[model samples]
Structure formats: structure tokens, C-alpha cells
Target: MKEKQVLIVGLGLIGASLALAIKKEHPNTRIIGLDVQKESEAFALKRGMIDEIAESLDLAAPEADVILLCSPVEAVKKQLQIISRIPLKESVILSDAGSTKSEIVDLAETLGLENFIGGHPMAGSHKSGVTAGDERLFENAYYIFTPGKPKDQKRIKALQSLLAGTQAKFVVMSTEEHDKITGLLSHLPHVIAAGLVNQSKAFNKEHPGAGRLAAGGFRDITRIASSDPVMWTDILLSNKETLLGLLDNWRGEMDQVSEWIAAENREAIFQFFYEAKETRNQMPIHKEGVIPAFHDLFIDVPDVPGVIAEVTGIIGKANLSLINLKILETREDIFGILQLTFKRKEDLERAKECIEKETDYLWYEK
Candidate 1:
């Protein structure tokens, strides 16, 4: 039997990642990439991610056993056009990495792809482009699939087989459920982040020193707002029904907060915070769980120039491996917290001890 062929369309982070992942997990599959950017195609080839790179989908589509559509949420229409135009000899599994599922799933249904599933991996960084691609990005992330039809189960399994190496948890949900749940947990938060950044900027414009006071808390909360604006706008609009409903609920909650503050009800304010904190404490979330590493060192340092460089220098001198570091503040008044993850737990401990000896920063191992 001939080896299976997987065609990946688009060569951005997600597409490049899918190509690398599928090639790694299912080495038997012949991976081929179709990218609009010829330079990206050449890069993918040089990286050995794909067996070959096609200049167009017209040349690659018909030969693929599976088509991984990795276009942005806003480009679902163009993806549908490409899928619809493909002339596969056999029924090929068509799947995507689009964030909002309802619209894309509906479009896929209309386009007549036999085995269409809309997938959204709850994994990403505040970065884009081919260079940001990592095969392990989906590890431990929730990969949701919205099946086009009941008969697409086999195709779903096939996709799962290819991703088995990533160790992601597979979740099957209806398009509506996927949109509503993701909008509440994922989409709504991004909107709030953007709103917060805007509010902070406006405040800084009026009160000149206000921006200087915002420390780690502000940057941590507003980080998601730095993501691709066009992509987020497309997602928010695409899932308007779910997002608007969430926004309405959030508005009511905000009103309650405002009302309590206006009344000068300290007890009510405390109660609101206590209850919210208790709720958050129950969630299966950790500081390093989503964005940070599982085994990491966290430090609280007084916000000062050259403090980060000094700490990193200490750790580097110790020869400890650093996986990634997040600097939570860029201001001078307030102290900053440094969250560092290491490749090994031993390195984490070594880095922690080394950094602790250098600065007045208190350290905690998380």
C-alpha cells in the first residue's frame, strides 16, 4: 500500500506546527505543504517539515489523504473555497484550526466536505509567524472538534491518531457548544484585556504618572490584548451571539461593583473579592499551568532598572538551563515578579537559589 499523504495549507505558526507534529507522530505519512508565500514554502522544505512544498493548493489538494487547514479564523471563507475546489480521488478528511467554530462548521457543511471537523486548540503564545512554530504547542491543551456529521467519526479518529504524540485531551462538542464555552472562557477574557489596556492608556493620558505605577498586575492582565487584533476581531464578530450574551452578563456584574463602590460599602466590596477569590482558587488553574511552566521559580523583586539583567546573569553564571522567562513589570515604582521555567527541576532549583542570593527578591517554587 502507498503511504498516506497529509496536505497542510497555509504555513503560519499553526500550519507549520501541524506539519511538524504530523510528520513527527506519523512518519509513514508523506507531508506536503501549500503556502501562498513561496519563501515560507522554501523555509518549510529547508526545515524538513514537509516532503515537498507545492506552489498552490491546486497542485497539492488532490493528492492529500488529509487536509489540515490552518488559516486564521477570519480566513475561513477562503479556506472553504480551497477545500471546495480540491478534486480528491478518495474522500479526504478536512479539518481546521479556526477559533470560532459555528460559522466555519456551517460553511464546511455547505461546502460539502464529507469529513469536516472544526478544531480549536486552546494553545498559543502572544506571537505569530512560521518561526514561532513548535510541535509541542498542543501538548496538554484541549483540542476540540466539531463534527460536520455523525459519519465523520472515523475521520476524527484518524486525526486523533496523528496527534497522539502531543498528548492533548480530545473533546467532541457541537459547534454551538464549542463557540459558547470558548467565548466565555477564552474570547471574553481577550475583550476584557483590550478594554483594560485602553482604560489604562486613557488614564495615563490624564494622570501623567499613572502609567508608571502600573506594575506586573497590569501587564499580566493586558498581555492577551497584544495578540493579533484582526484575528480577535474576526473571532468576536463570528461568535457574536455567544460573545454578546457574555458581554451583557459582564456588564451587569460590573454595575454591581460600581454600585457597591458608590455606596462606600466596604463589607460588600470585601465580600465580592472574597467570593471571587474563592471561586478562582477552585479552578484547576495555576500561575504556571497555562502560560507558565509546571516546574518554575517565581520571584518578587522591587521594580528597578538592571535588576532583571543582574538576576539573569547570576543564573547564567551558575550554568542553569532557562526555558523561558516572563518579566511582569516594565515600571519603576512598583516591584516586579519574575517567572522563570527551566528544562529540569534541578535547573529550576539551582536558578532559584542563585537568583535569591543576588537580589532582595523573595522566591517561591511553583
Candidate 2:
């Protein structure tokens, strides 16, 4: 095949990263990026994330072999409508990196864009924008495709080939399946995380010390609450029906737990927790899925100067890389807790061994 021209709209994190990954693997292929944010376009071009910056969809749509809509769900819907009116090439494969699929797929079908295929790359970070784009963001992640028609296998394969540079595991399913699964796994979690955060805020108003007492576990569980609210608001609204169903089921589960507690059934509560632990423990830890997992190690250290540097120095000397690190709590006289995050379990273990061998600090993994 001749060199492919890929046009990515919305040069945000996913769009810019896709451009970089494609360029890294297929240098001959041309990537054209377009975004409403002029700085994002300039940044992607200056960093060589894209070969060309499109002035408008009208001028770029015709030349693209593939067009990827990588904006927020609502923005993507508007782009699809605009692209529907644009005169695209006959062989152009249209797709998106949106979280939800059903609504987008329905819109495409309604617009008579038979070549449109729905895509959702199950990978992301808490960060946003072109600056945060990383070529390796989709590495080992699940890239799902939800094609609306049965006769689009050839187009699907071509689109897959175009995205092969991501090194993501590809899975195929229907739009319904994609929405329902993601609603339960991704959307519902965000709702619950935000709910928990709001609940904690209300509780903190009544008891000021409650917020300070929120430790590692609470922070970890509610981390998604820190995501871009506008983007998540669009996502939750787009998948409203699926989320409503999931929320109903979630409420029933909560009610059952409440009933168990009210009855003072010790065995029931014990079994509930035991079953939950077993199910959670059985989940795959190494694989990158819809939800990202953090491998964290907590260390107790004195609140003295160079104490943070000392622990990091030990890990660095062992050549172990940390994804992130922070001091969860520190006081003038009390020993502070330092949290170090690793990308893999092996690295976490190696860092722990290195720290123990070099220092007298007490450490535990979460």
C-alpha cells in the first residue's frame, strides 16, 4: 500500500499521542492534526507529533485515508456531523477515541457514514492536553472496536493496521456490548468516585478532622474524582441510559449490605467481605484494562531535610524507576508516611528490597 495519510481531530492527549505513536512506527505515513486550541496545534507541530496541521476539516477530509475523532464525546458528535457534510474520500475509514460507543455509532449510522467504525482505547492518565501526550500511553492497553455493519471487516483490518503502532490488544464487539461494559467498569466508577468525594466533603463540613483522616485507601479509590469535570460530565451524559441501569443495580447491592448490617448478621457480613476479597484478588493485576492500577509502597520516614531524597536515592541506586511519589503526611516531630508508586509489581518488589537493604525505614505495599 502507498503511504497512508491519517487525520486526527482534537489534538488533545489522545490525539497527539496517536500522532506520535503512528509517526514512531510508520515514519513514511503522514499525520495531519487539527484542534480548536491554536496552542495545541502549535505544540503538536513543534514537537513533531504531526507532520501537518490542518486549517479546517473541509481542506483535510478529502486527503485522509483515516480520520480519527479524539475529542470529548460531545465534541466528537459535532465533528461527526460536520464530517458527514464534508466530501471524504471513498476509502476513508472514520473512527473515534471516545469512551462511549452506542450514541456515536448511532449518529454515524444515521448520518449514512457506512465506513465509520467505533473505537475506544481503554487507556488514559489523570493529566490532559497535548503536553501530557505520550507515545507509550496505549502500550499493552485494550483497544476495542465496535463496528456497526457486518461487511466492514476489510475496513476494520485496515484501521487496525493503521493503529498497530500503539501495541494495544485489539478486541471486537457490538456497540451495545461496548456501552454496557464500559458503563459498568469505567462510567459507573467515575460516578461513584465523584459521589464519594462529594460525600466526604459534606462530612468534612460537619467534622473538619474527617478530611485529614482520609488515608491512602480513600485517596486511591477517589483519584478518578480529580479527572476533568467537563469531559466526564459529557461522558456520563452520553451514556446516561446504561449508567442508569448500572446505578440501579449498584443501589440494590448497597441496599443488601445495609440490610445485612441492620440485621446484625455477622456471618453474612463476613461472607460478603470474603467473597469481595476473593473476586478482587482474582482480577488480573499486570494487564492494562479499562481501569488503571497503581502499585504503591508506603514508607515511614522522619520529617527531616533530605529524608525524601534519601529514600528516593536508595531506589535510584538500584536502578528502579518510580511512576510517582509523594509525602502523604508529615509533621514537625512525627514520622511521615512516604508513598512511592511503581508501574509494575516486580519493580515495586525490587524497590522494597533495595530500600530495606540500604536503610532502616519500615515499608509496606498497598
CA lDDT, every model vs. true structure: 0.78, 0.89
- How does each model score on TM-score? 0.85, 0.91
RMSD, one per candidate, in order:
3.9, 2.5
Name the weakest run of 10 consecutive residues (lDDT summed) in model 2. Answer: 285-294
How does model 2 fare in lDDT? 0.89
Candidate 1: tens digits of C-alpha lDDT, residues 45-108: 8988788987577777788788888877767668787768778756688888888999988887
lDDT of 1 at 118: 84
Which regions of candidate 2 are displaced past 4 Å? 300-304, 314-323, 328-336, 343-364
lDDT of 2 at 331: 95
As a TM-score, model 2 comes out at 0.91
